[model samples]
Target: MRVLVAPDKFAGTLTAVEAAEAIAAGWRRHAPDDELDLAPMSDGGPGFVDVLHATLGGELLVTTVEGPHGEEVPATVLHVGDVAYVESAQAIGRHLVTEGGAEFATTVGAGELLLAALGTGATTVIVGLGGSGTNDGGAGLLDALGAVADAGQLDGGPVLFAGLSSVDLAPARAKVAGVRLVAATDVDNPLTGLFGATKTYGPQKGIAEDRLYEVDGWLEQLAEATDRRTSLVKGAGAAGGLGHALLCLGAVREPGIALVAEAVGLASRARAADLVVTGEGAFDFSSRSGKVPYGVAEIAAEALRPCIAMAGQVLVGSREMRALGVENAYSLVDLVGEQRAFEDPVGSLQALGERVARQWSRE
Candidate 1:
């Protein structure tokens, strides 16, 4: 039996690579003769560069950039040939905002990371956008790239954007004149309104529920100060309006998972495997979106292979799981208690993998 183990990062617990290794370890314990192919994936979030570096074998350039709160943070840029990959989450991810709300988080560090990628002499820069802890409409990013604002420093987040008089993106635009910029995003939400950055993702980054509209209005105001049209573009809301900033600079938007799948040759791998296993932190209806599990399952279906999932938690019904092209889904929280799953995620997932192998592996 041959199994293809591919999974996205399990949120706060394990990275996709770690998750794949854990599953493979347990599967090997149960079915020692079975072949296991580990292919970790990402959807332009935290593990974007790591996964790409693993499969693409790029030059990982380490650098220091501003964190969401203006502190210096370590970041890496994956340089492969003439293309560079930058993960926005490395600078402004939700996990980095330890003390403040989204209202004060900045995307300035992301801009710095982009500059680093550009410094690599890469003709193409792909900015992976998701897991952000900001809602500043990319003001900080523009500032980092030399965009000037009349009234604000641009690194203080959305609250400061409310006082902006005007913004000049010309200088910043000139910086990336000949380079091709790509916004690899997970969501297609615009920069402002109900589905916008502040409203949809602000709460998770610590925006008070009552202040959603207020912060959203600030981003709207920032957009008006700059380019309102770019604010309405799909994926503009990604990474707390960082996508809008990238769009303003003439970036093309593409699904992160799709980019990753193509880079990893996922379709060909699925066709070679007898069974495909994919997963994430939670297996829910939202998995139907451009997530790793759904994307992998689709490829598995096209290859006429059975696809199953192993997640931290299974929040969707069996029918919905099947609709996503997964034969079945396993959950660490379901097999072991939630405490145990969180306490020792690697071991818990390895155990879950062994159990799933018993049912799926023909050994």
Candidate 2:
């Protein structure tokens, strides 16, 4: 039997590679004779850089960049010639700001990453914006890019900024003027609306309900000042309005997972594989809406291969994924106790792998 182990990072517990290794270990324990293929995956989020680096063999460059809460954090950029891949989450991710107040968190560090990429003489920069910890409407990012935050009116909607203010972009602009910027995002939300960044994700970032409207207001003012239209653009609200900021900087937007999948040749891999497996930290209603599993399942479905998913947790059940042609869905929590699994992810993954291999080999 041939089993493909393709799983996303288990959030804080394990990376996709680590998870795949655990699963392979478990499968080996039960069915040593079965062939197992490891194809760790990502949805163009936090682990995007690592996934690309491992699969594509890029040069990893490490540098110091500001964190969400004004602290310095170590960040990396993946480069292949003039094209640089950056994961914004590495600098200003929710994981970095989990204990900090949302009011002060910003994407300035991400902007620094862009600057660093430009410094490397890379003409094309691909920024993965998924796990942000800021709701400042990309004000911090613009600031790092030589734009000045106007914070006009102080209504606190979307914090807008003035492009080319007292700060001169002449030097940096000369270096990056011809460079192309691509913002890769998974969400389709606009900069400001009922489903805007602050409205939908701010609460989770510790922003109070009363302050939500203010943040939205600030973003609107910033948008107006910068002469960038915030509303109506799909994905304009992604990454705490980082989408809007990039738009203002003349960046193009693309579906992050689709782009990464194409870069990594997932379609061809799925076509050649006898069986395909893909998953993430959780399989829920959201999984159907263009997550990694859905992307992998699409390719597997096209290849007419049975696609199975192994997740850390399965919340939406198997029926929701049926339309996507997912043949089976298994959760680590289902095979092992949640608490114990959380305590020892590798062990849980190994056990889960053994169970899956036993079941598949029996068939």
Which candidate number maximizes TM-score? 1
Which candidate's lDDT is highest?
1
Counting clashing residue pairs in each candidate, in order, gives 0, 17
Model 2 off-target regions past 4 Å?
98-100, 149-175, 228-231
Tens-digit lDDT track of model 2 for 119-175: 777889999888787777676777777763333321121333323232232443444
RMSD value for candidate 1 = 1.1
How many clashes (backbone atoms < 3 Å, residues ≥3 apart in a chain or on different chains) does model 2 have? 17
| Model 1 stretches with alpha carbons more than 4 Å out | none
Which stretch of 10 consecutive residues in model 2 shows the poorest summed lDDT?
Answer: 153-162
What are the RMSD figures for all models against the true structure?
1.1, 3.1
